[model samples]
Target: MPQPPIPVAVLTGFLGAGKTTLLNFLLKDPFLADAAVIINEFGDVGIDHLLVERSDENVVEMASGCLCCTIRGDLIDTMHDLLARRGRGEIKAFNRIIIETTGLADPAPVLHAVMSDPGLLATCRLEGVITVVDAFNGMATLDAHAEAVKQVAVADRIVLTKVDLLEGREGEDMLFAIIARLRKLNPAARLLTTHRNEATAERLFTMGLFDPTKKTPDVQNWLAAEAYATGEKRGRRHAHHGHHHHDHHHDVSRHDEHIRSFSFTEANAISPQGLELFLELLRSYHGANMLRMKGIVKLADDPSSPVVLHGVQHVFHPPVRLAAWPDADHRTRLVFIVKDIEKPMIEGLFKAFTDQISGGADAFTDTTLSLNR
Candidate 1:
């Protein structure tokens, strides 16, 4: 019998963003008791604290009750060796895999590798992407590095670390700004703040199509298109600005107008072909502009079930049709987190292809996209 695809989640963040802290927290879970963690060592960073036993030159078993090994060379090779060892019962038979990427590494390529590799595709599934953000330096990091921006944009979960450092009214104001900034970058992604408390591994671990337990996708929390469609998002944004504005201080969160999020809903069900055409066109012309796109579409042929689509950059993962709509109020809701792209253009292009998504975005104006700065 063939082995089921093992879910592999990539935990990433900028340097000093506390991914290591989160990883340590996650390894303590009983659910992940039989999981193999592959940690990527970049440059000369020492991870002696993470490993309790250096049984092998590269691999070590953590005292926190998990197996961890540093990727000494090729990631693919390391994974292959892991499976081979497990097959021979040399190592424990772990059912799950967690990959901790280097701080500055581009996570897209790691995702692409799993998607493209025939062997990894059959054995390992690219599951959730968890990105940690430093409450102290997150804003500065985003302003300075595009890599950091991309990490936030692609994450399934954003964990804000070092919030204990935030104190007083001034600190409170700064926290709001960073939260707002993260919201703008990825509204659909779930945000959790952790200073010293340990976040549940179950909450962060299972974010893919199905969890390790084989449960159905949590469409509501996963897509969260409603959060963007409703006025709640705008209210939250204004609330953030309100805090800074109350003190007569400038809003430091609006660092980059290029990266923004918007959503559009179509009342009528969309034909399968028409939906495909719109996506193709979107990816062909404005793919570079799109950072991430996800939606649960109501198919014209079968309105009873919804088709879920998720795309990163130009490359779209295979569309999956859920057994039923997540809720009763399932119209086609698509959310986009993009860079240097106006909402009107996407809405207009969507209209051109399907004539389904009507109306334009009021909050994200053309001027914001056209601004040189």
Candidate 2:
């Protein structure tokens, strides 16, 4: 029998945009009482989970820096575990799943994970993506942060949060102006306003990617056009190759030295133990230089089902196993966007590990994965 699809919702916004506040509100909603909540935050120390007021069992925290980064692997693992427990009747049956991402997260990868993961796709569907904007600081945030723009551009629904804080004459002007900006970035997403009313959740989650009845995502506007534009501006960033070249001769800083993107792939499928070792070395040698690293890896034993990996800085989340490949391209596609780090260094470290694994070395002999310990 086909398993029921899991509906996952990604909640994103700029820093201090009331994402946590909105999440807290959703948790208390009687209608959404049984929803599983996953919180992914940026920074070395994660406290957003603490800010969430929910019972311990239902609220899962992925503290590997950012949802779009280091802990992405962990997100998939957590979801799988949640599904297993729910299947076993160990937890309350949930009709929905909510993911609250850090201010700095890029929603593209998260969305990709939901859409591409065969396991998730078979049993789960993307409900919708909701982006919250701080009415008071919305303009400034959009102007100052690329991440903020990405968040708004990819949203299936936009929530104008903290309107009460902007109630005066000036506040009203800001609200209209921000709405105009969001409409331009994401023309398809339905706009909603939030306050103490708690109406945003209902509006935002009304749509889903795969409707059992409709057989298509009700929210059909392609947010990827915006992502493609940004990608063009970022040039053609290859996951294993590192920097994107703009025409002829170029002299760019290495991955660890400045902000850059790097790509790499393993010829043979990677072992689970090998992945664990690679993550540990990442924390030890290049943790501080990392911004975000995401990949769909080919597992040695489980080659049919690729293992999804995400990491931010030093923290590595557990791996997420997909049920099948999303497309024909099966090579592990790992994209690393880093600051103050070199691509060669990261690639070299991964190569060294593969060498050791081939030589019959175990985790104890893996010297690089020792940083976190």
Candidate 3:
């Protein structure tokens, strides 16, 4: 019998951000007693896995160059082996999985593997991304490292470590400053302030509907359509991130440093044909610019039902139409995190497709999307 897809949550943070510490803490929980852990350390000497206290059998370590680069093929093979063993009942049955990426690694490549691999996609589904930030070093790291910025921008949740080190009113003020910067960078991710070893697995794995315990994921939580909506009103850019890049020269890798995230909402229903054409055009022309695209859309074919959309780069998961809207708000909303995409270009594409809106919408800033061919 085919099993239900298992949810896999990623644990990523900049170096010295307490990612391993958090993992060590979560593993202590009775809730994660059945969880399978895959640790990827980006060094020749992969000792992080050894430091983690686990029963040996369920924990996996990939200590090669990095999951983002050299060891990708091995990572996929490892997934297959784990699934095969689980099916044979050769190991304990884990209800979920947690993948810990090295501090220096970019998560996009791992995410792309999960999204694009048909074999893995069949058995596993992405629950969410949990990024740990070194409270003491996060600001400096972000300023100095592109990987750190991308880590924060792409996460569903952000966890800060070493808050215990900051002291007095000075510490309080500095903490606020760090959080302010974080919100500006990725407004959608939930920011939590907890002492080390205190966050339960429950709080960390809240990746929308994928939880299964809940009938439907809080759509607002995953998409944060309102945050992007606010950014548009105030004038801002798009931000979103993981996974190993399939190709360095591919358009997706070109402008990763300047990635931004924002969203759009349409009151009028969009024609299905128009939506399809718009997406195709966006993927064909500016797919490289798009890091992640997610939305709850009101389609002309099914005005009462809203469609769910999610994609990385040019690859999109099949659209899912809900029986009814989760709330009274029946408007169409799309949240985008892209490297160099502009709101005007997407708005123009939508306008060209359907009579959804009569006029083009405004962008926080103007950008010309060079549509070659």
Candidate 4:
């Protein structure tokens, strides 16, 4: 019998965000005893790898039975070597894999590598992205670095570290501002504060398509479409007023303004061809700006069985069709996290393709093809 695919979770954050500390905490938990860790550093000497307590040289066995290794070459090659070694009885078989990326790295490439690699995909599936944010410095980092904003934008869970350092009224005010900014950047992600003892291993991992504890499809928690929908309305209202009143305190170089998170629902079922064309247009035209896109699509041929679509930039995983609808909300819902791409453009493109498939006039003419930002 074939073994089930292991879930791979990517842990990322900005510089000094305490990701290593969080990892140490998680490794101490009994639930992650069978987990394997791959640490990626951007220098000649791997400091993070040394920080992790280990027993051996190459594949260090953690005190908790978790295996840890530092990436010396290509990520794909390293993963393949690990799998081969495990097969040859060189290492213990780990049920979970956690990749800790360097602070300055853009997680999109990491995600692309895991999602696009055929070999890795066959044996492993993406669990989710967990991002660590420094409560004291997160706002400043996000204002200056586009990479930090992307980290939070693509996260399934946002862990705010260093909250214990914040004291007095001034610190309280800073924490409030940072939390508000984080929520605006990515409304779908679950936010947790370290000071409150909320960032636990059990709560952080296993954030995939299915809830292992419930043994059911957790579409609502995964998608959080309602949160994005609410954010979209607020954005429109802010835009209609001519200026963002809440953004007056921000600097001109703030990258958060470029990021947008929104969601839309299609009441009618979409044909397969229409869906294909729509996705193709988005990927071909604006894939670079698209940070992430995920949705449960309702097909015209089989409305009862919805298909889940997930993509990072131009690379998309194979659409998986669920056996049945996860909830009564049968409408096709999609959530998008993009930079410099507005919600109207996506909505218009989708409508045009679906309408054309429904026997309407060709909507792919130059006039409709014209894209603004």
Candidate 5:
């Protein structure tokens, strides 16, 4: 039997977000003994790899049975080299790979590289993204950096670090406000605190479709579609009222304003051709603005077996059809995290295509979409 693909997790955060600190803590834990780490740095002289508590050569063997290496060139070449060495018995065998991105990195390109690479796809699967947020400076970071907001928006798990520094009543208020802001940005992500020892390897990893501990597909946890649905409704209500709370807190959260996380659900099955046309038009028109999109589709032809779609920007993973529905719910659900793209535009485009497919109209030639509106 062919070996199953290894799970690859991306660890991202803004500068001084304590990503390295959290990584050090996780590396010491016994659960990540078989994990391999790839630390990516921008400059020629990499400091994060040296700071990882293991040093010797390009690939360092840790006492905890984890292999540590720095990116030699681009990420694609580096991953290929690592796999080559592992196949040649040059490094220890590891079941999991953790990629520590640079503090200033956007993380979308990193995900695009991983998801679009065919060679890597055969050997590895993207497990999830774990973004570390500094509780002390997270508010400011999110305000100043759009990248920081995108990091939190695309994360499967959000780890809040340096919570112990939040002292006094003012600090407590700041903590609560930041937490609320984070939930507003990405409600589906599981918020965790590092100070309380809540950010562990067990909680961080295995965040993909399959839950190893439960020995079953955790679709609800993976998608968290309900959370996005609730957030979408709340957003609509806020937009309808046209209420703006002009305050220091709201001013500092300017970046969060551009980000829109919402879910699009369909009660009936959709035609495969319609879904294809919808995705193509979406990618062509607003791929750059689309931060992330994940959904399970109920096909009109194969309603019993649903197809799951995951994408980062224009690059999307090959559609995988599950043998059966994970739960009783068979409706099509798609969750989107985008920047400056209105929910109405996406929903309208999808409806047009699906309606054309069902009504036997010329969807591709007749339909017109404009991002300006």
Candidate 6:
């Protein structure tokens, strides 16, 4: 028997970019009827899943702080489990997978995972990456959030949403400037506009990586188009990498914590239980301060395919699996942008998540190893 094909598409943009709204519209269509939806939110209270109306069996939402940062391992695991169930006749065959990133997320790492994983690449094809931009506050967000800028820069398709909500001359010009900036960031991406997110599923799916005629996304070309290609030309520049360069006193007075970001990656595959525990720990510590976390995770049990995770303040979306590997190298990569969290702390916690700490290392020792259901 032939293996079922899986098409993965990422929906990403800055906070309040109407990503959820667009998703709501997309999922309601008949075309998306059987697609498995994964929502990664970064908040203590995961309400987005509640907001999204879908067939319960087909949707999974991660309630951890950020899916991309904390639950990428979980994402891959979930996808594998989904496939196993499909093999067992547990659920209807899902031909497509849609991953929605947290608003304040950078899509590069997610794309890297999908385009680089080996197991995922064989069974699944990358359809395309769709970025939704809020016509109302997009310009201001682009200037403020580095993640938003990267989201626009790496999109295969840019969808302008909520244009009808904009009012007055300032709003109109802001919309135009937002589009102009997008053109500079990504010249080849197909552009689409939605006044109220009134777009057909066919139009949204057009940018997918798997052209029925051309089976796979050219891995080399896709990675090259993004910043990772010109890693040298881009420089070792991070939005929050140079904390020492900023005037701490002035920044505090001005409440510059609003503009914050961080990135981290690990060399080993994380245990599914370890990933969940790490997310719980993050929520217990930095839930309110976390803005976004997105990453690709390699699971110790399943190295062939990497899982994709996304999150927004306190709310985690679900993790999605790619069919086969995108490339040969397999390292768990995650990028996080937090409001006021320190980089060292983030790194320390990540290590703690994957490290084999002694059971007696802490006062409370309850790491039985369970995952997000």
User: What do the candidate models score in CA lDDT, each in turn?
Assistant: 0.75, 0.61, 0.70, 0.83, 0.83, 0.60
Clash pairs, candidate 1, are: none
Ranking by lDDT: 4, 5, 1, 3, 2, 6
Q: Candidate 4: which stretches are off by over 4 Å? A: 41-57, 210-215, 236-248, 356-359, 364-368
Residues 1-373, candidate 4: write the lDDT tens digits: 8677788899999988988888877888999998888997424433344344544565777777888887877888888888878888888899888999989989998899888898888888788999999999988899999999999999999999998788998899889889878888998898998887898888998578843445457787789999998877766676687364444477779998889999998877778887897888889888999999999998988899999988999988778788899898998889999999878888877766556345444554432547633
Residue 99, model 4: lDDT of 94
Would you estimate the TM-scores of all the predictions? 0.80, 0.52, 0.79, 0.91, 0.90, 0.51
**Candidate with best TM-score:** 4
- Cα distance off (Å), candidate 3, residue 55: 9.1
Residue range 1-373, candidate 3, lDDT tens digits: 7666788888898988988777766666667766777776434443344333333443442222111112344677767777777788766577787778888988777777676788887888788889999887777788778788878878888998889888998788668757856776677888875585446678888665456566665677788877766655433333222123111121333233476678877787878876787788778887766777888888898899888887777877667788889877888878887776677677656654445444333311121233442
Rank by TM-score, descending? 4, 5, 1, 3, 2, 6
lDDT of 6 by residue, 1-373 (tens): 7664577888888877777777766665777666666667534443355333332444443322111112445566656656666568755566677777777666655655555456665677566689888877766676666677667655667899878876798677667666655654554466788775446777787564354544543333332323322331322352336455543222123323343444556776777877787777777777656655556677767877777665555555456665655666567666564565656676666665566555323422332221111
Between candidates 5 and 6, the TM-score winner: 5
240-273 per-residue lDDT for model 5 (tens digits): 6635642444555468888989987887777888
State model 3's lDDT.
0.70
Q: In candidate 5, which residue ranges exceed 4 Å CA deviation?
A: 41-56, 210-216, 236-246, 249-253, 356-367, 370-373
Q: Stretches of candidate 6 above 4 Å error? A: 1-4, 41-73, 196-198, 213-373
Could you say which candidate leads in lDDT?
4
Q: How many residue pairs clash in all the candidates, one count each?
A: 0, 26, 18, 0, 0, 50
Cα-based RMSD of candidate 5: 3.2
Worst 10 residues of 5 by lDDT: 42-51
Q: Please state every model's RMSD to the true fold in angstroms.
A: 5.2, 12.4, 8.3, 3.0, 3.2, 12.9
What global local distance difference test value does model 1 have? 0.75
lDDT of 5 at 140: 86
